[model samples]
Target chain A: MTTAGQAPGQAQANLIAIPRDWAYDFLLFTHRNPKPCPVLDVLDAGETVSALKQDADVRTHAPRYRIWENGELKAEPENATDYWRDDLVTFLIGCSFTFETALTNAGVPLRHVDQGKNVSMYVTDIQCRPAGRLHGPMVVSMRWIPESLVDMAHKVTALMPSVHGAPVGAGDPRMLGIEDIDAPDFGDAVEHEPGDVPVFWACGVTPQAVLMKSRPPFAITHAPGQMFVTDMPDFAYRVG
Target chain B: MTTAGQAPGQAQANLIAIPRDWAYDFLLFTHRNPKPCPVLDVLDAGETVSALKQDADVRTHAPRYRIWENGELKAEPENATDYWRDDLVTFLIGCSFTFETALTNAGVPLRHVDQGKNVSMYVTDIQCRPAGRLHGPMVVSMRWIPESLVDMAHKVTALMPSVHGAPVGAGDPRMLGIEDIDAPDFGDAVEHEPGDVPVFWACGVTPQAVLMKSRPPFAITHAPGQMFVTDMPDFAYRVG
Candidate 1:
């Protein structure tokens, strides 16, 4: 189900599954870290049907699934049937792709998308408000918006708080303990043109980073950039 | 610490305490219902000091507390020292007072406050997104804002997503299944002036309603309108 060569906008063709018993903990994790782990939908244990998508199967619909055990990547299976359990609960998290669309609609250009590069992400000194055993520095995705459009970008993204909301910081990476703007902890960095300002929004990679650091005994998450697409329209997330 | 006779905007001069073992579940409940249960501060198990306030004591700070067992209100105590346990976790939820301050700063008048009546609240047909065993209809607080100030009210309140971002509905109460504006499931109803629009915000009472319906084995929350006062300023909740 992998769509590796797909167009720039089409990613997130997968789902992540975790043991049902840990479902509440994971939900708490996302709630405590709204910007990085905005929950789009959730499926109860033993339920294959998605509340966000009709005819969607949690096991087979996702083009890919990454299984992590004790903080180690054990498998990237095409389908999770072999690991599917009645007690496994599924969660669909909001992806930045939705906000990127909103930004584009508001006339903000995405340099990374234009250059066909992954948006640059960095591990910052900012500590996420912890929930249970999940605690780690917030991961943020940086974009270069024209100085004039920075406020517009902020408003556009702020309308959708569920998807990381507005940028956590703008102008200075050093303030966030990011020593180098050219180097990122994850993804490819794009160049900033003249008159552009460096802006950062909470990255969805945060949960994955916390999982890697905290090393929960068992967990599952969609591979980076591969999310579970929902039937809900982008505008559905926008608020007044 | 009770401020019962204080003027409007000076309430929330108290704190509530409960058993520490149920702290995580209670935190999960607040996270799932942020609007009604905005967590202003949380104390670790066995800790009585709140990170949000200096010289604050959870045991004797709150003027009053309502204890619930098996979903029934069992006690209203002036001090919870008798019930305090090492594992009891305490959370301070965000109150409408924060958003009302924002609205006032933006030149929007709160009718309930001016009329010296409690904000009208109703149990809607809309179901709150469930977390664990907690699930119930969303409860909303309604205030009448002049038609001209509705947009300003929205922009002001939307800045505080932690407290209940924007009005879920503005003009017609019937859209939210609220049949009579004069009749509220909770709180006193305030009169609407000519050209006033009834605006609804997700209420903090929602989590309480959910707890009552779901009937968690044990739980504790501030009595309505009697919230935990945090040293944090109201503007802290406002976003760009």
Candidate 2:
């Protein structure tokens, strides 16, 4: 099931597990490109438990996992325990659910959620600030909001910069290099009704897309729309 | 010269250069302890020119440099070119000046800047989140603000989370392990007059202190009261 709008107040996270040797650069990559990678927690090498939540084992906590070998998709496993290695470091990145909850609470209706479809994600031409060994374009998630409530939506998400922050663009898809609004790079596209303005936010899928380009010898990430919910309050990420 | 009042609009940074071997761990330490180490610019190994500023060299842009070997102070030089190495990775962290300028611009009078003294800083008992090979207690810089204006100071600084953010504590230094308010571990002590409240902020000196404890074989840092000013506008850090 899609994780968006699930566990209202609890924060959900995007998962990225890489070899310990590549953990440092990945951490740097997150810091340098914070809009796309708000770090929730970084489990040390070989750690399976999350410090942010009680009794949550990353190896089997998530509903699904995507394993990669040298930039090639290898398997979509029900659990990552079989793929878990002592030399792996797992990174929990802030997911959009935290902000979607905030948006829903603020009276901003999301078309994707209403249409029962996963949020559309696109790989933009915007290049992320490259770290030592990783470099790739940014990926963004799209939500159709009423034109009248665009400012309100921006204000709400701006308060929670940890969850992809505010919309990167509001009215135009071409500016971000997305040719067709209906053709998303990831997830299913939803219906766009009248007076709806397409809003784009930095997506946690960015690092995953980068991993595909940089070709890390081995890596694992959460399957699309499948997330790990943490006990930490969503308001804990509020900056304003 | 002190950097607190200088560079009214531009941002200032705390410098930390270490062997490339320790750069990854040090980068993680900064990310985990962002309040005390809000990263501004991290120069890749062997890079002397700052990506944030024009024609500024880390080796000579700052007025003074403190060289450390095995956790002990080895030398204080006017320039670091002699000590520079290809394997050295330099990290420029956010300095309090950016926020202090915002505080001043917001009409919050600072006693340290008014009295022409270096801001008093103390080592707190609060431990930083350990990352890889580095961990230590948090250090705090104290600013005495008028009792009624403390809220204004907080509101102003809270907008600049990238530069040490809001105050960690407002009153009672003893709670932070500072027994003698007049005897500061770093910088000069300032007089606390009537209607003044002591506000403490996470300081940039924290990583330097941690270096002393973790004992990295070689490191270089900016001398106290000396800092590098970057061309990046201070308002770029505002969250609201």
Candidate 3:
């Protein structure tokens, strides 16, 4: 059994804590590298009110925090007590951990994880439907599937809707309106060998881009890689 | 085929328009009665620019409009040109009419249509999740189903999510927090036979009740029964 009070570093990293405004940038950075920074929880401003989990204090839960101002990196803080507000709304969107587990269980080889590099992400010209003040093109994470099991790969991942769902566009990346797949919008570019169709799924970084574009007066999100572990079982979000 | 030049009477009766300050009440009413008053659209007070449908001139689209002043049905007019403002945000919600066709097509007997009376509705203890200024108990429409096929009835109606989408409660009226099934909160109640179960679907009149409770300074909704005719096909909203 993995206890919440195991390693001090892992415990503090997983705990919820109220982060300073500077923590926003750190979280955004983590969101950029979704494979490593899969978000599990977000605390609105003020006293880290626990919405999805119990005893999950946002002030001192996570070990570290980063802040961003006007899309620029600002500072990193152990906790975010000074940069809290009353109007902030927290969103506990799905993380990629669930999908990674599915892929690994299904015997799909992951290149980025194996090479110790960030998963490839790119900004597609295809626009996401804007919600309220949030508007931007979609940022997709790519995975290369071998020719033999591409169909099975799609079928397996398509079951999880909340965790980014099935690939938005498969086959050629150019069809998704990307001019140069080599120069991705964020993250490192990975080599795609023959017989591997680059699969893309809407990344959790979508909300970050939305947050950046909307520029809400005040907001708080999970620092990437630091996630609030929940009792919510992953299978609950899956569909047949 | 329903001709376009039908004087917009039935469609106009579906329009719910109010002054700028009453926006909150309008949203409330939508939450309360989700069936009959299914919010077809909202034209924010000052942003009179219609985007969802053409010929929906907020000021003069409906053949007739009702102005509610402090819960009182005060004035009837053809246009709200004098009450235009810039702060309003229009919302196009789903309507029950979108699903009624499906129910009839599936051989579900609609008593109100057969008797030429308004579908019966009542306020229940079921409270809708509050969003911003809108908050209130849910109102539901009652229907009768034969004893043998009640399960099939639920399966048939559950398919239409945009419309009311299945009964919230079945069998007993008292269980719905409704007393004296004949005395409906709004609309006239119909007779239910010995072998019939009183099935209820979320009512569209919810927004009105919510709007009245929230009491935004200005708001507007379609007068009951009248609706905006949309260009999109109803099947477009159905999910398989």
Candidate 4:
């Protein structure tokens, strides 16, 4: 979620769930395509407890909820009290917002934050390693990094592998089958300075893309930039 | 599996299978516990083909195999042809040997290789992020590195996240609940020099540990030091 204007410990709860039978398949899909679907936490079927946060409720904490049926968005409800099912399983996926603080702290500028727009995203020709009835091309978010600071940005983000670590590709949009950088599939495109390079990182939107393509019977996900806030610090995701 | 003394492209294929219904759960388990269970490739139910290699069969390639039933060792068959089932699914998990070559090339010596013994491993008090019916304390392998080269060893292994990534803990065995470094739970313990620091990494033995603890109805894994070799190179696991 966009951590741009939010305080460090602000409330940004968002929740998603799927049928219990499909829960294992969904977890497998995320595992097979980890960069784009890093799992932060998972709740067993019919469970309301949040391992990442103490005494947190998934059904009502999120400021907003989206209902999806057969790959179509059907409602934007204030809470999922009526939709809650005993057979539903919840998963807390890592979001790019988890690394934004580290990136900014390391002196890497973010164009989306500066311009007040969602990060530009594109669908790539790269097919994700498929797992059981789920397969689709990867989706990546683009950022313009000063050529000199690219390595610093990479290092800063690489520290947190849980949140789509490092740039998948940099300096060329064509390599990812993006024909026009200005015309992104999702989010708004921002301009790059003369010395800036187009850098791309795997986006969480990739799972949404797979859902749209595979058309699972039922599913739910956080709205773009609307993530569930966890008590875990960004540093917790870093590796030695 | 140990890469020492084995021919580079030799037949080291080992196979394991579980019920078709548990396939997604098994895959999800590996995905949830990636460091110790790096999945190299997976075969669809009833299929003998490997996406990572051409003309490879999971049932017969490895020099050895071990069978487990309801969490207990049942057999050590040379091949699984007699046990093959149409409903079985095969997965090729990433082995630490994938990163051993790089570690050596970076000038870090491996004690297990020098002593011709399996690397030392221990079951830590750290519980892994669980998936479905699988949950257990994390298991790790121990290696002694020259104090000055610990950073280099970390960076070398960090590049390959698929193969357990960097050391989870180093220099302090007590932090991981290891009462005595010399008394490891698995593999052979090696002596450490005065200036050598003990580095611990997520081990493939972790899934086995989970299997033993959770008592899954049925499960199979490569024997320690006996892994499924793939056509993919070690470099393939590296990231920027």
Candidate 5:
């Protein structure tokens, strides 16, 4: 049996099974805010989804759920056993938290996370290498780093190849093909002190635009700002 | 107007454009000793194959050429202009010199190069990831290194992804699924000093075996110990 839950600024607790439609909206919201809402897993239909933690019931895991029909929000369901379906595919996309954690551990400061603001995201002209039905321009989350540590920053982040390694471009925002730095495609802007260059990493929000463009007949994801935590520790990724 | 000429550490004095029938034996000799004979380019019948070096004249550019016919060495021609054909395909493969240069730059000492002996190569049970019409067990060149710095060595070399990055395995020889390390399938075995571990990198010989297996209608490659030295620097592959 599998259980799912979400916690703000912490690990998720409790588990719940919700309607297919609710799963879709929850995933959409999470897609909209991926950094805080990292998706861990989605259960296949006819499969008994249980948390690896093995305590929480997914039947009523998260405190809330939202249902969407034809791209419109339909209902707020506390529990959704009736809405379960025979065919549902789950996804586990990486979150920015992994890299953010890495950056902080390396002593690089992040203003957005410090100020309780969303990391600014920009859709660049650079096209992502597409896979299967998924196709979209890469969306990048920005952070400012001291000029002295720019090279160190690159070396540190490049090690995390799985979760968007290294910045697409540094020094000039225009080189990334972004028109304006202040007016970003998404999220709130932050202060960039002098001698600071903006660094960018591929954002997890990519799948949202991809899904909207791809428009699969059915989908389910975690709600925005609510993420599914997993058993994987960040330390496992470090290469010797 | 890039012309093939004498590359460093190459025993061949000049690049020779030989007739297809005459080049077979030289190609066979190259297959016999692949570490020293990294194939860079092959031009057939002159349909403008451009992957190896820019605008190479298979004939005239190479100072000497050998012509092979039906598993027999027949002629050594200065140029095979009259023997050129449109049916031949060129193969540009990685050279050991590239990886050796990379290792030296990263401070990983090479015993064979330092001792002026051929690097020891072993045939391993590990198989090369096959491509179209190519298949063979991987041949790896061994370099002795300090056991403590093994991790750093893997990291530094792994960055050179195009030129066989990282060791497939380290420490025990049998652990790599190889029964014997002392008696290599090819090349001279070197002495392993105390506190040294044997490190292995994929050798270019893989394609030759693959070619023999595929038995392409016709192919051309650089002679043993002869490589097509390019103007491109080693660092071009480090990042991207």
Candidate 6:
């Protein structure tokens, strides 16, 4: 179940849980690659509740979960309470969906949402700065914006740097080394309107890509588009 | 000597080198309390070179260094190359002086610089948000700004949150638990102009205050105002 356009003005976050032993490396990783993984909240070991959302419980809040063992997906559970461990450190990363409200409010059309599909996401050739044992290629979410509205979308989202801000690449799909625009590594393929150009923004899934490469003993994360709806307004992180 | 008004437009940073073992906790500490500790760069263990500056060495670049042994000042040396350790992870924090160049360009009168003194800093009753084993009261740098331009000062610095952004408090020292304005916790007191008001901004000297309380086994930081000058312009960190 995608949380796309789920809670209106409220923010949504991608959640990742890892063992306490590997938490430091993960924290350092996010700091080094902030654009793709802007940390919204970090819950210390055994802390079930999120600092960003007081009412949410990490163990059971998200609608779906992906449980991983040594970087291999072992199960897709509805609630992670059964797999929850005392030594897990949870990180809530800012999701691009959190800014959809502002885009919609500003009159920037979202083609994927109109067609009832997930936004397109892909693994890029971009190498993220390494931190300790965590390092991997950056993952980015793609949106097809009209040539006229591209600058407006960029300026609006640039104001909120805490979320994935500004386009990493706005024009060519080949520049980031993605061979085919039709085939995405994650999320759905969407139909584009006339005069639309592909725009890429750094994605929260970059950490999951890192986890796959690093191969921590165990990990858990929200399933695709199954974000934790936060209480913060979209403008809550508006720094400008 | 202070880097104040030195290298007019280039960025200057506060250097803090701590052992690799405690780097995680310190990294988390800065993330939790970002207003005072905006991390510009975190060099891995034994990294004497800064990513922000190509021609600088962390061990010998800063004009002065403070060697801390379990929170006690062991020495104030001219260079830290002698005290450099293979296990040290250096953090370059955003110094407020970085924005002073912009403030000066904006015609904001900085009384401390006018009087040839270090900006006055104070330890406030305001406790910083804690993370792991690191927690302490916030330290603030005060400047006397003309009441008319207070809003302009706020807008200019707010654009650069990486540095201590905007004023924490613009008036009434009593609100921040600063007793006796004439006597400051750090730096020399400055005289205010006719229409000036006491304005406090989050300070780079904050981590030094935290070091006294948390008491890590070993640490190294730049001496007062002896910032390691970087090649990047102040606008490099400007998001808006």
Q: TM-score chain B for all models.
A: 0.84, 0.97, 0.75, 0.89, 0.65, 0.97
What is the Cα-based lDDT of residue A26 in candidate 4? Answer: 74
Best by DockQ: 6
The candidate that achieves the highest lDDT relative to the unseen native structure: 6
Query: Candidate 2 at A92: error in angstroms?
Result: 1.2
Over 4 Å off, model 6: none
DockQ-wise, the better of 4 and 5 is: 4
Pairs in clash, predicted candidate 1: A1-A63, A12-A226, A12-A227, B15-B62, B19-B88, B20-B87, B20-B88, B36-B204, B38-B94
What value does DockQ give for candidate 5?
Answer: 0.04
Clash pairs detected, candidate 2: none
lDDT, candidate 2, equals 0.87
- lDDT tens readout by residue for model 5, A70-158: 33345555554455555443334555545566666777877776766666778777665443343456667788888887777777766
- Docking level of model 2: medium
Residue B199 error, candidate 1, Å: 3.1
Interface RMS deviation of candidate 1: 3.4
Report lDDT (Cα) of residue A15, candidate 1: 49
**Model 3 DockQ (Cα-based):** 0.09
Which of the predicted structures, 1 or 5, would earn the higher TM-score when compared with the native?
1
**If chain B of candidate 1 is superposed on the true chain B, what is its TM-score?**
0.84
lDDT of 2 by residue, B72-187 (tens): 98999989899988999989898887787788888888788888888999988999998888988999999999999999988888767788888899989988988988998888
Question: Judged by DockQ relative to the true structure, which candidate is superior, 2 or 5?
Answer: 2
Question: By lDDT, is 4 or 6 better?
Answer: 6
* Residues A44-79, model 1: lDDT tens digits: 677888766777777766556677787788887767
- Between candidates 1 and 3, the DockQ winner: 1
For model 4, how does the per-residue alpha-carbon lDDT over B80-153 read when each residue is reduced to its tens digit? 77767788777776666677878888899887778887778899999987776778888898889999999999
> What docking tier does model 3 reach?
incorrect
Worst 10 residues of 3 chain B by lDDT: B1-10
Q: Give the alpha carbon lDDT tens digit for every residue of B116-189 in model 5.
A: 65566676776654322334566676778888777777887666543455666787888656677777654556
lDDT of 3 by residue, A1-240 (tens): 112122222111233222333333333333333322234444433436554456665654555554545544365566666765554434355654456656766877666566555567777766655433445666787777777767766777666644665677787889888777677765567676678778887765555554566564444444543444555666654443
lDDT tens digits, residues B1-240, model 1?
Answer: 323223334324223344544544555566556666666566666788876666777776655667777678888777667766676667666666667766777789878777767678898888876765667888898889999999999888877777778888888888899999899987787898999999998877676677678776766666655555666666666665
Q: What TM-score fits each model? A: 0.83, 0.97, 0.68, 0.85, 0.52, 0.97
